[model samples]
Target: MQEQEVQRGVLALLQRIAPELEPAQLDGRVALREQVDLDSMDFLRFLISIHEQYAIDIPEADYEKLVSLDDIVAYLRARLPTS
Candidate 1:
């Protein structure tokens, strides 16, 4: 998938997990948990949503690598299957 597509998917998933979040206002470089009201469970749900949406396996060890929007996009773009 393209970078924008991955970013959009991440943002959409984040919104689902934290409805109050404003995707347009989010700073991609900032940590998602700090930017939104996501607790550990909510964050896990967000990661799970990503895995379900993209069919990518995200082990717990890699969770720290996905702290920001930029990170999530890069990580997913690298792992998502090409068409």
Candidate 2:
């Protein structure tokens, strides 16, 4: 997928997990947990949502590295199959 498409998917999943976020607020730098108040359960849910969307598995231990939009995009770009 293109970067914007993946980003949109990620942002949409985040909206499902944390409805307080506005699309405009997704600046790709906001710390996710801090901005969304996501706890462990929410974190897991977010991971599951991402996996379901992208068909990629994110191990539990690696979730901490996904603190920001750039972080997630970089990680997912690495993980995803090259076109």
Leading candidate by TM-score: 1
Q: Residue by residue across 6-71, what tens digits does model 1's lDDT show? A: 788788888898888888899999998889988899988888998899898999999989998999
The models' CA-based lDDT, in order, is: 0.88, 0.83
Q: Candidate 2 has what TM-score? A: 0.85
| Model 2: ten consecutive residues of lowest lDDT | 25-34
The local distance difference test score of model 1 is 0.88
Candidates in order, TM-scores: namely: 0.94, 0.85
Q: Model 2, range 1-83, lDDT digits (tens) per residue?
A: 57877788888898898888887865678787776778989988988988898888888789789999878988888888778
